[model samples]
Target: MPTLRDIMTPGLVTVDPQATLKEVATLMLEQDIGAVLVMDGEHPSGIITDRDIVVRAVAYGHDYGTAVTDYTTGSVFTMEADTDVQQAAREMADRQLRRLPVTEGGRVVGMVSLGDLAVRTGGSADETALQGVSQPSADPQ
Candidate 1:
């Protein structure tokens, strides 16, 4: 029964919403992370993941110089630090999201990925949740 605080990648990586997709990609690479928060002051305005860049931006021939927020999941869904791993997994799957930002005291604290869930849940995780998230979508953005 690991909590999100136990397994999440502690520490937040953020970018201004105005930053270009290219810049966001560069940051993710430099940090060795798959997601970054688009911060609007102290709150998150959106979230962008490596998959989002590839599926939503690259696949669509979106200009690299366009603002990252344009491709971000603008209505961000986050989990509190103490949330159970299984609960987090279910929510992510239901949302068809691969990553989620972790929060504490209404502030970004860490990040969780499906990979984290797999490892923490002893690799079995949840097949239905995994398939739900991994399914292909024709979403334009």
Candidate 2:
């Protein structure tokens, strides 16, 4: 089995937690990426996704200047870089998470996304994992 170290995108584009939603949205658009890690010092504190902006901020009638920490998913889950990709996929599927910060020695090293696993694994397992991750639930939290 491949390890996350082999497939995780090995550099993170991050923003400080105090950054405004507008700034985060602009960064996501400019980078053409759906997610950005939110940092506290050198450690990842949370993740902000495009969907988060729409659902958590805009839907709540928050102004663009609202701090990202006000809406970012603060209960973040991280995976070790050496963890098996299959296990990571299972965890993501189970948690309905699209992206996970990859860590080494308690420091963030990279990120693993559902799309990354789907593209790399290329099998029924990957398809199943993708489907699981994509299924919508009544709970959006």
Candidate 1 residue-wise lDDT, 40-103, digit = tens: 9989999888999999999989899999988888889998999988788788887888888899
Candidate 1 local accuracy as lDDT?
A: 0.85
lDDT of 2 by residue, 1-141 (tens): 798888889878899988999999999989888999999998778888999899988998889998999888877899899998888888888887788889998899998887788776665346656777789966967
Backbone clash numbers for all candidates listed = 0, 0
Candidate 1, residue 80: the lDDT equals 98
Cand. 2 TM to true fold? 0.90
TM-score of each: 0.85, 0.90
Kindly report which residue pairs in candidate 1 clash with one another.
none
Residue pairs with clashing backbones, model 2 = none
Off by over 4 Å in 1: 124-128, 135-141
